[model samples]
Target: MNDVYVVGVGMTPFGKHPDRSAADLAAEAILGALDDAGLRTVDIEAAWVGHVYQGMAMGQRGLGAAGISGLPITNVENACSSGSTAIYEAATALKAGAYDIVLALGVELLSTKFRGALAPDESDIEAQIGLTMPSVYAMRARRHMEQYGTTPRMLAAIASKNKFNASLNPLAQFKKPVTVDEVMAGRLIAEPLHLHECAPVSDGAAAVILVSGKKLSQLGSSRAIRLVASALRSGKLEVGLPDMTVEDLTWRTAEAAYQQAGLGPDDVQMAEVHDCFSIAEATRIEGLKLYPLGEYPARVERGEAGLGGRLPVNMSGGLLGKGHPLGATGVAQVIEIVKQLRGEAKDRQVPGAKVGLAHCRGGKARGVEGTACTVNILTI
Candidate 1:
């Protein structure tokens, strides 16, 4: 099988884009990625677009807006993992030689879709029981506090850290850093989760150009970042209640990615995790084995997960500070990794970052750990 490499990455500034349609945002990102790759519309061999709550034919509409037509276009939706799943499919196709060059775009216009906390489908048992994303995460935060003695202050610190990182990210939604105390004082969304600790309703898009090893050699692109691994897994039905503090889906998916890359957590220099909520960062990093279970709060306290720390995480500000435009989220995480690997993340750059991991977990279903989870590893 051929290896896959990312030749270019692009993203719209993640925030409220009331004036933009999803197609327009996607077109902007697509154009930016094409320009970054030093390629044109005609060079793309195939495409996949990810979205949710946007009617139909999102892939065709977005690509057509970018002047791409007469090529295969697939639309994917796996909740928040939708965009990352598109990348996984594109990479798999490249490895199988089904396509030499592929484009993966993730776009969402949530500002016009929903007003408040996002929830699972109405048919979901959890949703029927009045469980919104915030409440679910709040329950997890409560569990962590009960099980690990994780304090509310620590959770607030995570939000502060991510927002501070966002302050350095020009494209991030939350440009100003919030103090931990300020975070603690913000209006409560759920028990331990404050408004500042939750990901905002964002509207944006991100796109990436993937090329097979053969195509990369043909193009001789010096900016290429090798995609060493892309692993995706769906949540399994739980036979019994499981620990909310741990993420089995994330662990399983990340383990597959690590094996594929022939590397372990210790080798990961930095990461962009699905910090949909403040507690999510702790749970996900532990699930990926990037940090010891139940110790992440302390790690954050020591600044071990900050930009200059031992293992910087969410340098893009993550879903929390960067904004969570579901479909755009996963691809945006990969873009951040690509930037850090290419030495192009500027102010939020992790120094000498050679290997990076991007984790995205999405959706909740009845009697399942999670609906979908994806782990992607990249190397410079």
Candidate 2:
């Protein structure tokens, strides 16, 4: 395997756009990324796409719409981590010396018809148990409260801060900021989680162009956000131990990435982690060793993880604030880091950002914490 660097990035405003199909939105993002790279779609050697809800061959339609040439294309799906899978695939391909320039993308246009998530399958144990993502996250929230005495007010504060941050992002889905009191009084969907505490179903797309170390010069305007390490792990029943879980998978993945990059949490200048829910953000921080178990909230309350904190996190508002377009989130993370490194993130830019770490996790796969996770560390 060889070095891979992200040289370009793009994204659409995350929100309801019932007028556009997933293909159209995805193509828009691809065009933006190509323009950002000062290249044409024809320059792409291969591509990987991730989406959880789109119908058959929709990825092909996106590529064709973007005027991309006949290249090997792989469509991927890994629930919420779908977008990250696209990034990992592109990096792996480039590292193998198979392709010098590759495109990694994720796009989704969620509407009210997102019933697939609600559909039940008799043979599926969780579906049989009626355990949707909201319910499962709610359970986790409950456990956090029962064990650590985490409060709803704290969760509300997290939402409020992220919302304020997202207000500066022109492409963010929600611009209206909220008060902690408002969040506390907001309509309750699941106990301990007001409407503001949960992520909204959003519609958007994000894309990025990656190149091998040798092909970095192919890019015109943008410089390299060198992809230092890419690591992915899936949970297996055999790995189950008392402390073993999907959260543990994040730690393992980050460890591998840390070893590969020769960096640690202390070295990371910024991060855009998977924050599908409030508790998830806290737990993941601990799992990644940014803090200890059950210490994230205290760290968070001290403003240690905010925009000007020791290690600023989720400058893109994360999924909770910017809206989770599921498939697009993973690649969007890379896109945001590219902007931060390039000094192009006008408002959300992290001062003196040079090293960044990011991740995306999704669904209940064969794991204790459920689903799979993909992590990457980058430097410029």
Candidate 3:
């Protein structure tokens, strides 16, 4: 099997873009990736696009706007994990030797589609029972506090950290860091979770170009990063009540990624995990084994996850600070990790990053831990 490499990555500024369409955002991101890779659209043999609420044939429409046609284009939707799922598919094709060069793009114009806290599909019993996205994380936050002695202030600190990181990220939604007091002052969305602790509704796009090892050698692309592993998993059905503080889905997906990469969590120097909520970041890092269970909050307070700390996490601002454009999010996470690995992240760069992880978990169902989870490992 041929190893896949990430040759180029691009993402649009994540925030409200009421003037733009999803297809337009995708075209911009795709062209940017092409330019970054020093390749033309003609070099791409196939494409995959991920989006939700963008209607049918989104990939074709987006690619058409970019003046790219007459190629195999697939549209994927797996809730918020849609973008990462597209990346997974592209890597699979590269490894299968079916495509030498492929494009994976994720875009969402969420500003026009919805507002306020997003809920699961209405058909789901959970949604019917008034289980909203914020409420889910809030419940988990409470559980973490109960089980780990984490404080409301600790969770507020998490938001403050990510917002600070966002201030350094030019493409992030929130460019100004908020204090823990400011975060706590925001209107309460759920018990113990204020509005600032949640991810904002955003519109954006992200794209990545993947190539086979042979193609990498042919191009002599010194900037390319090895895509060591791309693992994806759907949440398992729960047979009994499970612990809410921990993420079994994240652990399972990371385990698969670790096995494929032949490296443990300790090998990773930095990460961009799904930080859709302040508490979500802690559960995810612990699930990835980057920090001990019930200890990430303390680690955060110690500056261990800061940019210059032992292992920086969410340097691109993550979902909370960077904005959550649903389908565009997972791909954006990879874009950040790739930039960091290449030492291209200007203000938020980790000094000596070599290995990075990008994890994305999305969706909620009645009896499952999560809807879908994806873990991708990249190395220089």
How much lDDT does each candidate structure score? 0.94, 0.80, 0.92
Show model 1 residue runs off by greater than 4 Å.
none
Residue-level lDDT tens digits of model 1 in 1-380: 89999998989999999988899999999999999999999999999899987879998999999999999999999999999999999999999999999999999999987898889899998799899999989999999999999999999999999999999999999989999999999999989899998999999999999999999999999999999999999999988668889899999999999999999999999999999999999999999998888999878978999988989989899999999999999999999999999999998888899999999998888888789999999998
How far is 300's C-alpha from truth in model 2 (Å)? 2.0
Quote model 3's TM-score: 0.99
Off by over 4 Å in 2: 115-123, 218-222, 238-246, 365-367
- By lDDT, the best candidate is 1
| Candidate 3 local lDDT, 269-303, one digit each (tens) | 99999999999999999999998889998878778
Q: What C-alpha RMSD separates each model from the true structure?
A: 0.7, 2.2, 0.8
When sorted by lDDT, best at the front, the candidate numbers are: 1, 3, 2
In candidate 1, position 231 carries an lDDT of: 99
Q: What does candidate 1 score on TM?
A: 0.99
lDDT of 2 at 300: 69
